[model samples]
Each structure stands twice: as structure tokens, then as C-alpha cells.
Target: METQDGAELCFPQLFNTSCKKPSSSTTQAIILYTVMSCVSLLIVALNLLVIISVSHFRRLHTPTNILLLSLAVSDCLVGILIWPGEVFMTTNCWFLGNLTCVIFMFVSIIIISSSVGNMVLISIDRYVAICDPLHYPTRITVSRVKLCVCMCWLCSIPYNSLILKENLTHPGRYNSCHGECVIVINPISGVVDLVLTFIFPITVIIVLYMRVFVVAVSQARAMRSHITGVTLQLSATQTTKKSELKAARTLGVLVVVFLISFCPYYIFSVAGDNSYTSSAGFFVFHMLFLNSCVNPVIYALFYPWFRKAVKLIVTAQILQRGSFEANIL
Candidate 1:
């Protein structure tokens, strides 16, 4: 059967039976899957370390760090639970039975929805802290952050659960290995899922970040004015202003990286007209997978403390290994 993107494949037939031998497209898919798997695993490992280190070290447990830890945990779960099935679907084939297919697809949808929702929460958190600093302390308590995280997952459940049910009930006519489930292409359902998953969340993120940018700029200007009024005193006020500017810059970097990694996939999914051609689907899948692997690097670049922490952790690990070797000798 042909997918929406125009790649050719046999469907309703199991992977082993679809073709007598592996094809070039299959080889490419394998390579892509392998590379993505390795990258995602590396990202997961690093993020896990970040989470653990932050939790263990007293100095690293600020509210901002707590949000970062949550993001890292989500990414790690995505890497562990979602990426493996993705790799299998990309490389070997969809060999899992119907139950697994539903579970995998359901979990993946939840993870993705939660990831985007968490980003929205992060943006809102920053926006409130920067724009309404006077009330931020009272507004952004630990309980509130926890509630936000819980709400994200709660919001995700219905969307993913519906999609999962649809995939299981409506096996596409051309589906190879009818055992594996996929979202059936009903235009209405597709449009709803697209709007809920991509359109609304993306709009929220953009609006919140825009507000954040405006607030940041205003604060910077006010700080400059206050500094001038103080006869160009460059110590306390200047340092505080500089730190705020740095934080704003870091948030900007994060927003950019997020958009860069995920935009293509969303755009393609929204515009592709539901054609499941193997090539286009595979290409978009790969891009989405890349998104899961990008957060660590972005964090390192934007957060100096996180960067230093990672460095210290790595150095300590190396030293410990050396000492152990010496003892063995």
C-alpha cells in the first residue's frame, strides 16, 4: 500500500511478508532510526543526570530549577517509552500485537502533548515572573507549579485516549499487518486533533512569549533609566539588570530552539493533507524525533548554572573512574 507521502509499501501484509528482501528505503529507515535512537538515548541519560544531580544538590533546587527538572524528566520518559517503538516502526517493522500498538500510540500521544503543554507552562511562568515581579512570589508557589504539571497531563489524556480508541477501532483498509493500529483518516477527526494539539498550544506559547519579550524589554529600559538617574552607578543596579537581561536572553534561546525543532513537523502534519506516503511520514517522524534530543543542548547554552553542573558532574565521574582503576591496580 502507498502512504500519503508517496512512498510505496505493501500493507495488510506483515513486515517480513511485505517484501522478499530489504529495500533501499528500508535501509535508509534503519540508518535514520539507529542514529536517532543513539542521540535520544544520550539526551535521556544527560537529562536524567541533570534531574538527579539537581535533586541531590541543595543549591540547585530553586523554582526555576524545579521546572527544568520536570522538563528533563518528561524528556527522559519520552526517550525511554516513546523512542524505542518509533525506532522499531522505522527500522525493523511494526511487529507488536494490536494491544501493544494501541498502548504505544496512546503513550506517545500523551508524552507529546505533555511536552508541548509543559513548554507553555514554562513560558507562562517566565512571563509572570518577569512581567509581574511584584506579585510573582505569591502567584507562583510550589503548589501552583505542581498543579500546572498535573493539569497538563490531565488535559492530555482525553485527546490521546480518543485518538487511541479511533486507531484501534478503525483499521485503515490498506493497513499492512492489520494487527498494528494507526489513526484512521477521517477529515473531521484529523482537523480536531491538529487544532487541539498544534494550533491552540502553539498560539498560546507564541502569545505568552511575546508578552514576555515586551516585559523584558521594558524592564531593561527602566533599569537603564534608573541607573542613569543614580549618576551612572554601575555596581548593584547594573549587576541586577545584567542578570535579568541574561535570563531573558536564555529564555529567548529556548523558545527559538523549541520552534526550530518542532515547527517543521507540525507544519507538515497540518498541511500534508493526510497522505501517509512512507517517505513524507518517515521524514516528518525523524524531525519530530530530533526534537526530543535537542533540549539538553539548549539548556546547556541558555542556563549557565546547568552548564557548569554538567561539567562538574562529568569531571567528577572521570576522576572517580580513575581512582577506582588505581585501587584495582
Candidate 2:
């Protein structure tokens, strides 16, 4: 009986100090592993297409595409690092040590915070493009957007490090036993994280998008009423307006989907949820992970340029000389 019980412990030699193995049946664990593996691969592959599409095609190198590229980079990291880490936590012990666990925690927080920052920046971009088109060309240049993306990432590292400072200084402080990896955010830090990372960014995104939507609808109505007769210059202006409106609609969908995926995790965390072992916590986490996969799908479904670029990429046409000069838009 002692031998059999020892087999259930994550570190048999540790005896009383070791964590017990997870209790799920082998079949269920296998199914979960398979599903998560496929999702991780899909996330990486799709985001890679987005990254290449925006980077290789000069025509797609607009300010908005630059923001999308930054987002895809963050999402790809989610698949490359976070997914594998979560899977390992699910199926095995954290034998990698407390330092590794804290590092993973820090990196994951950086990714999450950067994603929120990107969403806020995208919202601001759309707002300027739609609500202040005259100044947008001067205001939202590619160079400016790239700088903002860099600042977003650079700021994330320090911000999250501050939030996880306790865990960083005392790795594995929250672990109940050997073979466990955990981090606890005290109530004070949790409130700060909730406000800055969740509430503040979300509020800004919602407000900017709301203003963009209102302006877009008004512009669309104006264009319809003025459709009868116009000079060539006025017609071209109308065409630009139409394209801006279409982009607003597409990005509106993106923001809504992001909120749907992200809100549950924050909500559950606020409700005092502690462990991903619980069904509710499990669902919340996977919902958040699914967002990274769903974003590239949104791009494919809404952006004609994305579809055209993907076709070129998959057909090996992108390898041809002068492909960067190809007209993707």
C-alpha cells in the first residue's frame, strides 16, 4: 500500500511534502492534451500568417497593419510559451523549479498587458482615422505607431514586475508543497491590476470605439444623401470615407470579441476564484487562450487584403523576387 501511495505523489522521495498527482482519468487527460495541442498549433500558424502578411507586403505596411503585427506577435508568444506551460501544469508536476515558475508568471503577465495596450492603441487609431481624418495622416503615422508599440512592451515589463514583485522576490512562496507552482496576488495588488490592466484600458477602448461608431454612421448617412452628383475630387473623398467606415465596422467586431473572451477571466478572478482545477476557472482560462486563436480568424474573415496575402504566402508566390512590391490592397 505504501508503494502504491508513493506512486501517486509527484515526488515520491519527498513523501509528506510532495503534491499528489492530479486526479483526472487517463482518457480525459489524453483528450484534453490533444485538443489543447491542436489549438496551440492553430494559434501559432494563423498568427504567423498575419505577421508575414503585414511585414512582407509593402502596401499592407500601413499604421493599422503595424498595430495588428504587434498584436500577432503577442498572440504567437501565447501559443509558443504560455500554452505549453499550462499543459505541463495540467499533466505533470512543476519540476522546473520555483525560479522558472516565477519567470513564466512574469512573461505571461507582460504578454497579457501588452495585448491590452495594443487594443487600446488600435482603438485610438480607428478613432483618429474616422473622427479626425484630416489630422489622422499627420497624427497616426507608421513611425508614431511603431514607437507606441515599443513603449507598450517596454512599459509592460516594469508594470507587471511591480505587480508580481512579491512573488519575484520570494519565488514559490504561495506553493502548498513540493512539486507545486503557484503565485498569489494579495488584495491590494489585485485591485491595482484590475483597475489598470482591465478597467482603465477597457474603458478607453469602449469610449473611443463608441465615438468612432457614431461618426462613421453620420458620415455614411452624409455620403448617401450626397450621392447624386459630385466632382472627381469629391467622389474620391467619398470613396476614402467609405473605406474608413468599413474598417471601423471590422475593428468594432474585433473589440467586441476581445471583450467577450477576456471579461470572463477577470470576472471570475474578482469572484474569488482560486484554482484552475475548478471547472469554472478552467473554462475562464481556456476562454482567454482562445482569444489568441480567434484574432487571426477575425482578420481572415474581415480583411480582403489578408485573404489575398495569405493566398500569396501559401502558394510560394511570396518567395518570388519583387513580391514585397506586390499589390496586396
Candidate 3:
């Protein structure tokens, strides 16, 4: 399984909990799990709708939108395959047997790895488009975007595939009866995954975005200088200034969303290997999982087009409901 650094560090403690006898307070656990499962389902549905809406509407089919659609699809799979099973196991124990367990674990790993990889790709795409406008069009063509998506999947395949094989074949060392299938953390492998999945990609995103901000600032300054040189063209300068300001605001929002969604999990994981056993660790992990649901809501609230679409859909639904009520009466 693709355990994040926090999970890997904390697995020993979690494994201990899993091995304990079944609890009688399972009803409470069940209720909590069910609620979370429903929430996850709702998020998956919303993201799926967003992806479909973007795909079907010709206006939303740009390269950035395509990348977002791919992310939604990946996250949808994660929510569907991983979250329900997680909810089930948390309350009821592992009832799915070993084969299904292996499959579910494999799927979870693949989806998470793919999702993170897609995020990195998105950051790179944005960086190029924003910072290197002259070359972006030639460099980031449709075919090239397709290739990048393909490459992300290709990179994820080996980690998920090998872990699945290991789980199936190494039954002596591994136990699936407890309802958890995770990679046994070898120090080297654990470090490698942490660096590749979290450290390296995050570093790249930070660096690229920082460079983009610097470039944007420099361009704004240069534009101001040009405006002053051209006898203080206030109208053109103001328009250009406004556009630059909006771009900066958009990038700022993106960075904030990314940090809010991902930073806690990474921080908890990296602080210390022993930190995962604490109650705080579990809370942080759950918080990270919940972040998958945030992107659609963020889009709806922040982007005018998405906000309009959401309003239209909601109004139509309400009108349809009212008509049904009247007919029934």
C-alpha cells in the first residue's frame, strides 16, 4: 500500500490497534465511519460532475481544465475504492477476505500516487504558462499534455504493482486477516517513497511557483517603467496593471489551497518517525483525506464561471422539486 510518511511511521502503532480484539463500542465507530463514507461519496459525486461538465462543455476544455479533469477522475477513484473500504474496516473489521483486500490496497496506492503526480504536473504546467508565455504555447501542446498524463501513470505503476506482488506472495511475513494491507516499511524504501512522492515534487512546486511570482513581479515593474517612458499612459497602464494583479491573486489562491490541503500531512510525517502513533497523527491524516473534497468547493466559490454553473444547477434542481411537489399536491 502507498502509505505516506506519517502512515509509514505510525503503522506499528496502528497495526497494534488492528490486532486487538473487536470492540463492543462498534456502533459508535460504525456511525462515524458511515458519516465519513457518505461525505466522501458526496465529494466524489461533485468532482465527477465537475469533470463531466468541463468535458462536455467546449468552453472548459483547455489544457489546465484537462489536467483538473484528470485529477478529479483520480480522486474520484480514491474516494470510491479506498474510503468506503476504510470506513468498513474501521468499524466492522476486515470482512472482505485477502484477495479483495489486496486489490483494494493496490488500487488505493495507485490512485494516491497518481493524484500527487498529477498535482506536480499541474504546478509545472502553470509555472510554464505563467512564467514562460513566449514558449508555453509551442511547448505545452495537447499531445504533450497527454504524454505527461501518461508518464504520471507509468511512474506510479511499478510502486503499486510491486507492493501488490509482495503482499500476495509474502503471506508469512504479512497478515491480511486484520483488514489492513500496507507496505512494511524498510528504511530505504520508506525514505525513497517519502522523497519521491512528497519531498521532491513539493520542492519542485515551491521553486517553480516562487520563480513564477518573481517573474510576474519583474514584468509588472518593467511594464510600469514602459508606461512612464511612454508619457504616462494611464489607461493602458491601469488595464495592464489590473490584469497582472488578478493573475497574482489567482496564483496566491492556488498556493494557499495547495498548502492547506497538503501541508499538515507532510509536516506530521516529516517531524519525527514516532509521531504517527499519537492521536494527533490520526487526526491529521483524516484532515488530509478530507482535503480531497475541498477543490470543487474552492472552484465554485472562487471562480466566477464555476460559481455561475453551480448556481444554475442548483436553481434548476429547486424549480424541478417545486414542480414535482405541486403536481403531487
Candidate 4:
């Protein structure tokens, strides 16, 4: 009995007060940790490349790319801070103390919320470019985009601070025993989070993308049918329309992938089964984290500029003087 209890407890020395170890077998735990560690490293490395690519190349500094940069920054934080912390929590006891746990949760929420905000900004940017191309040049300037990115991040702090207020005031209040860390979102806060973060943002993204799609399709049809006379003026208009449509398609993919990654967590939350200890919750939370890893991958697939930037970065050609002015687009 003593041996069995010792084996199950996270901290054997704590005896009666200790939390139980996860029921996973030794091999399973080892495999999970190894996979998570590799993913952590990959997420950090990939997003770091994105950060460098966008930041270094001057020609890539368009309004849409600015939104991507903000997203990369938030995703990089997830890789650098959130993934490793998750790995540690999954495999070990809560040795970091309640204060540290609370701080970790706070930072994690802020980064995630900032990511969602960046996605919304991206959608809005694409909407203007596709739906209102006449004013896109003036409306979506670099300085304005930079300001929006700053606001997205700054607003996330206060927004998430409110969501995690219970944890802030009383860290570890939900812990069942020593060597454990957990957060329990009461129904009111959970509902508010669901509506604000998941439901509202997703609704806006879908609606905007739907409009973008309609406009893009109509523009494509116009170009194909040669509805307008084929003067040099018409040719120029066609080229511009094609560019806008392509951007919309690429950004549409980005938004769709983000929704795919984010929806599971909220869905489970709404089902009232988002217990942190449960397997489904664990999987969904990591699914959300995986979005950070996949964003640059999507960029590489759809954006030739990202591919070119990666090549320059990997070859160390970006180190040369005036490389920032390279024609990445």
C-alpha cells in the first residue's frame, strides 16, 4: 500500500498532501515530453525565422506584412515562453510556486489574446485591400498598421488581466493538493471569454472573409470575361484586381487555419468539459498552441516572398549591407 501510494504521488515526501502523478505510463510520459520538447524547439525556431524575415527586409514592409509581423511576434512568444512551460507542467509537479504559476498564466493569456487581435487586424486589412481598393493605399499605411499592432498588444494586457483576475488575487486557489497547479474559470467569466474571444472574433473573421471571397470571385470573373475594353488602362486595372484577389486568398487560408486551431478549445469549454486535467482539454490547449507553429508554414506555402526570405535568411545573405533593401516581393 505504501509502495503503491509512493509510486502514485507526485512528491513522495509530501505523502498525504501530495498530488497524484499522471496516470500515463512511463513510456507514454517520456514520449509525450520528447514530442512536446521537439515541438517547442521547432515553434521557436520557425517563428524566429519569420520575425527576422519580416523585420530585416524593407520591401516586405507592406500593411499586410505588418499584421503578419505582429502575429509572428505573439506566436514567437508562445514558442519561447508558453510551450516550454506547458511541457514542464505536464511532466512534473508544480514546483515553481503559485505566484510563478499565476504570472505564467497571465503572460500566456496576453500573448494568445494578442494573437487573436492580430488575426482580426489582418482580416480588416485584407477587407480594405480587397473590398475598397481605391482607398487602401491611403487607409492602410505603415504607420497606421504599426499603431494598430501596438494597440492590439497593449489592449490584451488589460483584457486578459480581467479574465484571470481570480487567479491573480488568489493564486493556486483551485489546487487540490501540494505539487499541483490548476485554474478554474467560473461560469460567468468563462461565458464572457467565450463570447468575446472566440465567438465574436470568429464571427467577424468569417463575415469579412465571406465578403472578401464574393468580391474576389466577381473580380476574377470580370478579368476572365474581359467585360471592360482591353486598353492599357483596363490592363492595369486587371493587374491590380488580380493582386488583391491573390492576397485575399492567401490571407483567407491563414484565417481558416487559425480558426481550425482555436475552435476546439472553446468548443470543449462550451461543453463544460474543459477541465485542465482531462485529456481532451490538454489536446485542445496544445492545438491552440500549434497555430503558432503552423502560421509560418502557411506563409511559406502561399507567399513566395516568405519562401524567398527564408532562403536569404538560411543562406546568411541577409547579413550583407543593404540586404534590407532586397526586392523580396
What are the TM-scores, per candidate, against the unseen true structure? 0.79, 0.96, 0.75, 0.94
Off by over 4 Å in 3: 1-21, 24-27, 163-165, 176-182, 221-252, 263-284, 311-329
For lDDT, candidate 1 versus 4, the one ahead is: 4
Best by TM-score: 2
Residues 1-329, model 3: lDDT tens digits: 22333232213445543443334466777678778878888878778766755655556556776777777887676577766765554444454555676666566667767877877877777777767665877988777887888888887988757534556565323553254433344455556667887889888878877887787778778776766546556666556555544544564575567667667766765665422323465466556566667777766665665665555455664245333222110
Give the per-residue lDDT digits (tens) of candidate 1, residues 20-95: 2224576787777778778777868877866866765556655566776777777788778767766565445455
Q: TM-score for candidate 2, please give it.
A: 0.96
Model 1 ranges with Cα > 4 A deviation: 1-34, 169-174, 178-181, 228-241, 272-277, 315-329
User: Candidate 3: TM-score?
Assistant: 0.75
- Where does candidate 2 stray beyond 4 Å? 1-7, 274-279
User: What is the TM-score (0 to 1) of candidate 4?
Assistant: 0.94
RMSD of each: 6.4, 1.7, 8.6, 1.9
Q: lDDT for each of the candidates?
A: 0.66, 0.89, 0.63, 0.86
Alpha carbon deviation, residue 309, candidate 2 (Å): 0.6
> Residues 1-329, candidate 2, lDDT per residue (tens digit)?
13354457778788878888777789998898898889899999999999999999999999999999999999999999988787777577889999898898788779989999999999999999999999999999999999999999999998888888899999988889888877778778888999999999999999999899889989999999999888899999999999988888988898899999889978986887533445576577678878999999999999999999999999999999999999878
